[model samples]
Target: MTTTTTLKEQVLMTLKRQQANALVLYLNYKKYHWLTYGPLFRELHLLFEEQGAAVFASIDELAERSLILDGQPVADPADYLGTATVTPSSGQLTVKAMIEEAIANHELIITEMHQDADVATEAGDIGTADLYTRLVQTHQKHRWFLKELLAKGDGLVS
Candidate 1:
């Protein structure tokens, strides 16, 4: 394949993976929003809902970017679960565990976004590179928030 073709495929793959990750993350946030309890219930519930909205928006952006590159974005909910790099949480988890899970999921996406951005840059796809850069920044910010929450107090409640 030509370089342009290869780059397009790479970009599309990255976009799809990102879409999947965002979908899973959004769903996980919603889960936590509904299930979180105890001392931090109100705070964590609101935060999870807000984060869910943010991730849902990112999912739309990823799909649009894929279409802009003339690639079909995965649209089905099942597809998101199947393609996601971050696995969805199952069973019951404590509030602290939910926070830790979110942090880990963000880390997974951040690592993938960094790798995708590097590939896009090497392939001369500046737009895709920029997209990944922005995504990385967003995930990093989210990760920082989760980490800071974990850091507060004596680990019992933050």
Candidate 2:
């Protein structure tokens, strides 16, 4: 591939990468929500719903942004699963374990997103940069939520 690729190509590639990650995480969050138990079930269920909602929203924005950049988006779930760098399936595990898995996944996405932001910046793609930065913030929020689960599950006063 040429170094001086069109802005659309860079954006589409990055968004595809992100979309793959987001789709996996979104479904994983829903899985956790459905299977969660214990005293924290209500709180965690709501939190997962919110987190899943946000991930879905972010994907919508990212996919639309790719369209704005004049590229087709990867929308099918099978395509996402095939392309995702983050594996979503880990089989049955404890609720807390699921939360921890999600945290790890989100952090992984964050690292990739930072690199994606740098790529967008290098390409002078401000729109994609803004999207990736927002995504990072969203991942941080989800990480905090999952961390809170660990803290709460541990019987902490906080």
Candidate 3:
């Protein structure tokens, strides 16, 4: 295949991975939101719902980007958990555990975004690189919010 074709395929694969991850994250957030209990329920339920909405938004953007590149986005909900790099949690978890899991998943996505952005840049696909950059920034912000909730005192670190 031509270099262009190969690069396009690689970019599409990366985008698909991201799309899967976002869907998994969105579901996990929604699940946690519904299952949240204890005194922190009010706050955590709202926060998880908000985060889930953000992740749901990213999912559409990723799929549209894939379509724009003339590639098929993964469409089956059943395929998401298998394709996603992020681990999905089921059952009950404490608020702190849920927050920690989210932070871990966001970090995973951010790391993958950085790597994918580099790949896109190297392949001379600036638009894909820009998309990955925006994704990284968004995940970073989400991570920060989760980390802050886990932080002690001044919220400088977690």
lDDT sort, best first = 1, 3, 2
* Backbone Cα, N, C clashes tallied per candidate: 0, 0, 0
- Give a tens-digit lDDT track for model 1, residues 1-158: 24656877987888899999999899899999999888777888898888889899999899998998899999877788888889998889988889999999999999999988887888788988998898789888888888888896665543
Flag regions of model 3 displaced more than 4 Å: 1-5, 153-158
Per-residue C-alpha lDDT of model 2 across residues 28-102, encoded as one tens digit per residue:
989988988877788888988899999988888878988888787887767988778878857887876888889
Instruction: Estimate, for each residue in 14-109, the C-alpha lDDT of model 3 and write its tens digit.
Output: 999999999989989988889877666788789889989989999999999999988989898788877799888866777777888999999999
TM-score of 2: 0.89
> Candidate 2: minimum summed lDDT over ten consecutive residues — where?
149-158
Which candidate number maximizes TM-score? 1
- Give me the overall lDDT of model 1: 0.87
The per-residue C-alpha lDDT of model 1 at residue 13 equals: 87
